[model samples]
Target chain A: AQSVTQLDSQVPVFEEAPVELRCNYSSSVSVYLFWYVQYPNQGLQLLLKYLSGSTLVKGINGFEAEFNKSQTSFHLRKPSVHISDTAEYFCAVSRLDSSYKLIFGSGTRLLVRP
Target chain B: EPEVTQTPSHQVTQMGQEVILRCVPISNHLYFYWYRQILGQKVEFLVSFYNNEISEKSEIFDDQFSVERPDGSNFTLKIRSTKLEDSAMYFCGGRQSSYEQYFGPGTRLTVT
Candidate 1:
């Protein structure tokens, strides 16, 4: 079985500051990686996805994540954050053979201060 | 850009009662799914539907859980004898392929 681990439960940052949310996965087989964000009381919105090809995957809202196979990590990063960026982020993984289902991380709450 | 949509954005029901959550997946999508997230927890997959049947389900989905695509467009999840623990946000998602999935706003089920 595959699983995702988000190292940080909460990350607090100031406006216009850089932020990185760490994510690691354990999967015996090859997998697809994704990052999703959820605003208060809203559904999840996709940030980025790493299916194959380039290790560096850029997403909406100026966010990006790198898929490192050797380290089994896909950490999400943003050069700068705004107060509107305060939301909960999740890291998810699905096996390449069967990508229909997803295993999600515990989630990291990004709190952006003004 | 068509997106998945769900009905009854919030529902309140008594324990031991039955609840059905409804979803309308994007048109022409081949795969459908149901997932739930408890307060302050990760989103957990419950079941996946394809060709009018279930493809995969988690241990969390037991006898109490049932999914059906009653018509051409609607996908519904029925929970029999709901418990307080069943209170959570249920999300509906659809995908044309294995790469990307579009998720609905979700239905907040509250069992008291």
Candidate 2:
């Protein structure tokens, strides 16, 4: 089984400021990591993922995440945020050798204020 | 680019009523899934489907819940008797070989 923890329930940042949303996971086996963003009343959009190779993964919308094996963490970061970036961010994980069902974190609400 | 689509953007039903939410996954995708999120809550996986049958399901997929690929283009989730707790935004997704899943806009079910 895989479990994810997103520490902050809400993050308020001024527009153009850098932001980081913390995420941690616990899994006995190897796993795939992902971050998704959901706008109000909309579906989740893939932000980034850590499947293999480089631990640092870049995604759409100028977002990125680093998969730290020792820390069991995958934190999402952006140098500058836009007001449109306000959304609910979810961190998810799936066991590599087991079922592909994704276990998601409680989510972090990003409020990019102008 | 192709993407997943869901119908009946919003549904209102009385308690104990049966409701079916529909979805059309991306073409060429083999895996389908259903997930739900109540207001202000995290998304929870309900079930996953492959090869015309269920591949995996969460504990929340109780006897009241079922999934089907009635046709090549349509995937549906049926709730036999909706409870107040069943009210949530139900999302349908599909994966084409990769681990990444594409999601639909979702159906907001309101059980009154």
Instruction: List TM-score per model, in order.
Output: 0.98, 0.98
**What class would a CAPRI assessor give candidate 2's docking?**
high
For candidate 2, the TM-score is 0.98
lDDT for each residue of candidate 2 in A1-114, tens digit (9 for 90 to 100)? 678999999999999999999999999999999999999868999899899999999999999999999999999999999999999999999787755778899999999999
Error of 2 at B1 (Å): 1.2
Candidate 2, residue B16: the lDDT equals 98
Share of true Cα-Cα contacts across chains kept by each model:
0.59, 0.77
Cα error, residue B10 of model 2, in Å, equals 0.3
Clash pairs (backbone) in predicted model 1:
none
Model 2 Cα shift for residue A2 (angstroms) = 1.8
Q: In order, what DockQ does each candidate have?
A: 0.73, 0.81
Q: Give DockQ: model 2.
A: 0.81
